[model samples]
Target: MKKLFLLGILSLFLCVLVGNVALGEEEKISIAYIGASTDLPFWITLRNEARNQANELGVEFIDLTPPSMDAQAQKNSFDNAIQMGVSGIIVGAADSRAFDDSLDKASEVGIPVVAVDTGIDHPHIASLVQTDNLSSAKIAGQYILDHMTRPGKVLIIGGVLGHQTGDARKNGVTEVLEAAGVEVIFRAADWLPEKAYEVAQNELAANPDLTAVFAAWDPGAMSAKSVVAERGLTGKIIIVGFDGDPANLKAIKEGEILATIKQDNVKMGRDSISLLVDIINGKEVPKYIPIDGFIIDQSNVDEFLQ
Candidate 1:
């Protein structure tokens, strides 16, 4: 009887040890990621990549995007993540200042916040993972200058006015074009395809002789391309944009877009999560982590497309 009792006790102890090990292995660290909009393929790809990376690391990633690029919707998402007690947050803020309060609340609750693609101006942000927008824009601008002999009027299809990425790209192009003595005709688009199309139509209507069009993003550029084709001005106007989406690559192949800047979005997602993980694990993180971008033109579109 005594021997049997001892065996039972030993078995219970072993079971407890095994259970603890299993629990440790199954321990999930929850992370929240919010983007401007999920409708854009670029953001979709970025979120998927981030989720895949989180899964590999035994982390739970919750991705949220507003129905549109609505600031209040993004703030609500941030608030929801905070209420759910997420370990960390990675946000591509719709507006830099819109999330300041929510970010502060997250910080108060001891949740580290990392910004990806777009940045929050608040100091409480743990880190920022984004491309060097200005440098990428400069590459596109140089390509345009080289492709067009001497400087004629070029249309600048600007993105959402206040968004950091859009503003940076516009400023970068403006700087480069001015330096190269190119006349820039400005037009505004809300970063929506429809809005971009309208802007493109208006620009073409005003400046039919425009030599080139520089769009802040790929979708906007593609929208502009469609309008250019509709107006029967395809070969006459060169189109350059940021973000080397696969569709953009196809456009380049078909001789629609001249060039695009390919951001390391996958790397951006991976690095942002890694940085947040480090902070959660009590490691110090840098305030800014800038990732560079590459220019994809006809000569190198094949490389990115493959």
Candidate 2:
């Protein structure tokens, strides 16, 4: 009987020892990603890739997403991360400037910040990883020129007039179209979907003979697609978009959108984690990281299908 008791105690001690080992493995280096909401495909992919990269590096990833596009809520998330004293922070702020004071606080605490997609200028920012919006927009414009019907009337549904990303994309396409003597009408929708939808329908009503349409983002492309469908003119209008979002890919496969600029979001995500990890390890990181964008059309749409 004493032998049996001794054996059971030995098993219990072995189980406790194994449990401690597992607990030790659970708490490694921790990384936090505070960015846009992940309900949409683009943001979801970005956060997912970052999480995957974190896992690859054997670190914990904290994904903090605002309920929606509320700037206040996004700032609150930043505050929460700062309060938690995360090893590092990644910012995709709705309003980059809104975090001015909070960023200073983060800096005071020595938490390095990396901006992705949407840029926020500050001395404490370790790096900015984003798409080459201007050049990619130029590609879309040149595509319009390449496939444009002679004497074409093109509609450009642009982002907010003064915003950097929007302006870069708008300018890229406009520079190409205007220089080629293409008649273009520009509508600034301030990056709102409903606004884009309104602008699209109004322009189509006024100019039923549009040769092509260029949108700054994928949703805008979808908006244009829907508007064109409403008038039973899907294939009639050559549509191009930015942000190689999933729905837009399906649309391109179906022959609705002609093409879109596909940002290397996977690189952005992986690189974001890499940069922060480097910073945590006292390693140097590049100031500006630019990921190229490519055209997604029916010819290669199958290659990108999820």
**Clash-forming residue pairs, model 2:** none
Model 1 Cα lDDT, one tens digit per residue, 120-152:
788778899999988888888888888985347
| True-vs-predicted CA distance for residue 64, candidate 2, Å | 1.4
Clashes of 2: 0
Regions of candidate 1 where Cα sits further than 4 Å from its true position:
1-26
lDDT of 2 by residue, 1-306 (tens): 999999999999999999998776555556668776666567778888999999998888988877455567878888898999888888776566668788899999998889888777788888999998888888999998998655668999987666567778989998999998888899998666688889999999999778899998888889999999999988888999998999999999999999999988888889999998898778988999988888989999999998
TM-score of 2: 0.86
In terms of TM-score, the best-performing candidate is 1
Error of 2 at 279 (Å): 0.8
Model 2 spans > 4 angstroms off: 1-28
